[model samples]
Target: MLKREDSAVSKPEIQKVGKYDVKEELGHGAMAVVYRGYDPFINREVAIKITDTDRGNDKDSAAHRRRLFFNEARIAAMLDHPNIIHVHDAGIEGSYCYLVMEYVKGAKTLKEFNKKNEILPVEKVIEIIFKCCKALDYAHSMGVVHRDIKPSNIMMTSDMDVKIGDFSIAQIISAEVTQIGGIIGSPKYMSPEQVKEEEITSQTDLFSLGSVMYELLAHVVPFDSENVSSLVFKIVNETPLPVSHYNKDIPEELEQIVQKAMAKDPRNRYPRGLDFAADLSKVYRNLKRPVVDIKEQAKFEQMKKLNFFRGFFDSELTEVIRAGAWEQYGVGEHIITEGDIDDSFYVIISGDVLVKKGDKAIVALKPGDCFGEMGYLAKTQRTADIVSLTPVSLIKVSGTLIEKMTVHCQLRFNRIFLRTLIARLSKTSEELAKYRPL
Candidate 1:
């Protein structure tokens, strides 16, 4: 969870691991100690989590700890996201196994702001949690579920960027690994299903995130009792006091988000992190804090006006709206980064963008122009960067979700996408033919 220790129990009595030099103990828990280390090759500081070799002679405990330790390395390293901690490397050096992770220079645990006197402004909470939802959505799309998603597992940078850390107990759900069941999670933030050791999914993390959000807003956990058993009972069988009950200043729309997130039934909770983020984005607007005033219906209308959706029916457009996000960015903002592995097709619904490779402008895109054609068809990396040339509004659609649309809708959409790609190729050929010395 990237949790730091108040005091060191003992040092590892070592100077280095591979090319990294151990500086000091950053924190220590029951199983491992996080040390501040320096990577000589890259010339940067990193957090080294070294698992204890001698927890006990108990093989099961040691095995479980080792598995969990490596699990974080294997899973977190694969997740290349800004909001998720990046795992650089992992290896075994004699008896000690360790992970090299990004050292977030100056950040505070979400725990610090959950106190009654330390609550952040409502707008900031919406911004912070919105990023978390997007991050978790990305993780869920990749088949990783952070089983423990409490406040301590989430970090906020000095600039207010959110990072979800400590995937040590995260489970990889896939076709082969159908379900996971274990009474394994932080009790205070555990969902009803978690306490019961029911099959875990992305919803479980959403429920935990709800508890964190509740604590942040109301200055109290949704369900709490000094008595452990009573707390578990409350989480499983009771409805939490409405968030507005504790903090009347909290908006009803925001409270509903917390309520839906913490719903006792997984089915009642947000179907996906994308849905969670969409609602929060709406609440952000209701608070009158949106950068642009595009509501859902307005966004739908914008899409309808786009030549990209000319032949699609309103019902089909509604499905498209549900399957995508309407986002806004200021001028000079980088809409797409070169070399990033993303599969989101973007349509400029308003304003313009400059598509550049490095510093050279390859082309300029206007409203109704589309990009990510290849990405829409596969999990490919971007070759050019798309930067906003003006205040920009975009509809970002993930390839994964687009596949779930109706067959007729897909056919129409693909036909148009193919046309756009072919037209671009033809234009390039004509330009190249002019340079040929026949």
Candidate 2:
């Protein structure tokens, strides 16, 4: 016989919920216990969220929790997006109710990365938040306001994919509030309007997302306090320290994006999620370094290990990585031709290059060496014909892009280029001296 338990048991243990077998506990929150459930009928794994109505301090509070549980199911069912968690089914059996949702194995909350003492790579942070913006945009277009947009509610899969979940507190843009003067959501990430118990809109989500992004980049909540009242007060009246203040590595443009999104006045914040996403896109594109995707990131990492980029700041290195393309050439391939009018500089990442004066090979340049800079600097034709001595990997930087670098970055590059040129000249002079018979 199957045993049934509802409300409370001396030992709180659950084995089944509806048609799903609850295998193990995934996580527990103030109002629900999530389990890794197996759907026998569908032959698939799912996440079953069981409502804990006992979260309320009083009978009315318990009733409110129950209502919100069903509300979340309804709201989640209304959204369908790759970056938004999908709801499979919701049902109530006896005195228990559960929602079977997409079980993203190995998924962890963004809260893990939103700490005051640590942060992920800036490129990674930007990528994650950009996805969040797109997801929020879709939800807003469907007339839903995700009232509870916080770091913990955002999940990150093992492959770094993002999924926004837990829309239980969400409200329809046109619906009237069932709970008068009610303030719902994580206080720390709430916007000024939410703190003041004013009408909420899509801009509110933008503000919350900004707060989440701020924490990820700076490692601290925009507003922090020991008590709820003080926290709420600060949220409505305070301005957070610029993100760059905490992480000097953060660029001024990125900090400005965060500040604009977290503006105290909702009217001043981004009008739509699309607008917010656009701003993020602009910053990501304009960054001195590329954090665009995994492939680009791998290339950037390769540049960091090379000796030529040793003096470049991490930020400047990113600029260098984005300013050029990493390319490969086969042996006998011409890299530069004598008398060719071009100003592109090249750095040997691997393999070798042969520098030839007309028909004779003058030098064999190895990895970490550079070529064509003399012509590039002089804005003239190449003085030597350069060819790949073996299969080669190289970075070809455009003079046009290099000109756009920050003054400091450009100055550092020039210093290194000068040193390299001087060394090469000295080597050539010594070799020529030996040819001059006594």
Candidate 3:
């Protein structure tokens, strides 16, 4: 049995409801317990959400508290969209009111995806959010507003199907609320109005959706803080850095859309879900075109900052930059295998590469770090496997290119090459000593 909280009893201990027999406890929230159950009548599996009745003890009593749980079920049952999880039934058995919903196997939340630190392709992100937009539009048309929209509430299945779940904080537009400062939603995804405890609109949902997209692209939250007070202050008053600042690969049009969606003023943001989806579609189309050579230009800009190359003549530095070629590799993909005959030394342009001797990793190479220098100097087989730890980009200078350059300018090449080789060997020896037995 999979329980959200470790202290909760296993699913078999939970009493059966109607024809459904609990198989496993999937998760538990503030107001309900979600379980994987077998529906004997239907001869299939379903997710059963059981409301927590012992939440409050007053004249209003447990029944009054249970009504809010049922309200969430009622609102979810009315939402019919491919991206929305369908509610099958809702009923009370003794003290528990349970709602039966569709069971999606092998589904993970956006929070789980972030743990992997993957930078999603722009097209795929747009596709996922397009489905979310349609679902929100449909929910809005039915006069329902999802007050809580966060990464944990959105599920991505194995086949990449997006499903929105957890409608507990949803407002029915017609309902009269009594609790002020109840603060019913996730803080990180809340819009400015929600933070201030003001009336919320469809624009609030769009604001949350934009935050999710921003995180997917940049691998960081819009406003980051370690403490609760600082986090709240930044979310309410501070503006996030432009997405392009972190990830240069993001299309400019897409960046603009994210910025507009997260605009502090609701009026400045997209008016409706449809408008947001339309902008994303347009950006997707533009992204399919050939990318300009901006990355190469960035490399030259970086070279200008290097102190080692500062004293070199412009023509010499330009020649060295022109001789380099960009190479990319997936994590664990071997850029250079130990004992292989190779004459090229690599300068890491971005990301990290792991230097491995046998099955153990020796060290990681960050931007500006060079590898295979020992081989280049000695003209021998590679001493270690250089594998990518993340998606990596490097500038490769082939043995033949170095040879040609050395032939043209022997004195300069000898001075620089010998110094680089000696430094690399010294570092390698120091690293090896750390791993050696005392």
Candidate 4:
């Protein structure tokens, strides 16, 4: 946490709390201001969350709030998991109750990430949500329900590790503390039971997790409302557009897991967070196959959309299409090999292929991209292995066909082919430059 006081004289300059010195304000929430601070006792940096005293008057009212705040901290501190932020210390200093927590560097809220890239890849979305499921499962086993689970509460590091934060609304599932008929959580992510003010269970968290996963995959909330009343009504009554509806690329197995996790009836949903995680793991395995087919005509149309293929005449393209043979590959199948004695070129028709040096992918080829053309032109062995990342469809053109076309077709077609080959080589060179050493 970093804390910095405003230059305005009216505001209080944040003072040192015990052995920790406040640096600059990291963020502000409804009840507290989080700051970056250096802990002299530990000889390391940590985040300090300080409650604002301005919100309440009198010592008794302040004391009650402090007790409630520390109570939440005490519950959080008891749980130890890698995905959960560790709480170091919590105490009252003067009028403010402050909590010292682990300092995670280079983290961004999922909301901030979505504002920049509206949608993320399905693989990445699944990976993050799976981690959240495991963390939530661990918390649930300890009789804790994170009442609020949303994009804003999820922090993702640069390496793609996910941490669920802001446990202010977390409810202990003990019968003595469980509050009936009390709605507590963000409405957008609220489970049907939560909206109805029913008993909060582990299932409630699963529903919220589903909503977060839905937003991550689709880039839209599962339920939308013009007002709070309508929002609550929808949460209890409505079913969102299937994850596949927004992004057809999402596999059926994944879509099914999300749908089941978000079921309107708690009984119909995943019984525990582990169940949800297990389903997601299955989806991860299924994601290796093609989600949908890419027809030959669709492949051609996609190719025409590529920038590298600009200004290519239909007559020239027709010859290439005539010589090409469509081939389907299973996931992990090798379409070509490095140093293989084959003079065949290929163009991606559907799915994804990886050009690799041995086992490592040097480049990924989506629809419209061409590969092995340079080798075909030089009449030499492949420089890299082309392996299918997903179940793939490619248009393979043999060297013999190209030689025949060169002999039979006019020189204009040959000139066009040479130019197209050069254009593809230029694009590949530019892509390879990104991985080159500085």
Estimate the Cα RMSD of every predicted model relative to the unseen true structure. Answer: 6.6, 15.8, 18.3, 16.6
Clash count per candidate: 0, 4, 0, 11
Alpha carbon deviation, residue 45, candidate 1 (Å): 1.6
lDDT of each: 0.82, 0.81, 0.74, 0.75
Which prediction has the highest TM-score against the true structure? 1
Q: How far in Å is the alpha carbon of 340 misplaced in model 2?
A: 36
Residue 222 CA displacement from its true place in model 3, Å: 1.3
Q: Considering TM-score, where higher is better, how would the candidates rank from best to worst?
A: 1, 2, 4, 3
Task: Candidate 4: list runs displaced more than 4 Å.
Answer: 1-12, 53-64, 116-118, 175-181, 288-438
* Predicted candidate 4 versus true structure: per-residue lDDT over 313-355, tens digit per residue: 6665666666656668899988887876545677776789988
Off by over 4 Å in 3: 1-12, 55-65, 117-119, 175-181, 289-438
Worst lDDT window (10 residues) for model 4? 2-11
Q: Model 4 compared with the native: what TM-score? A: 0.63
Q: Considering lDDT, which of the candidate structures 3 and 4 is the better prediction for this target?
A: 4
The better candidate by TM-score, 2 or 4, is: 2
True-vs-predicted CA distance for residue 12, candidate 2, Å: 3.6
Q: Which 10-residue window in model 2 sums to the lowest lDDT?
A: 1-10
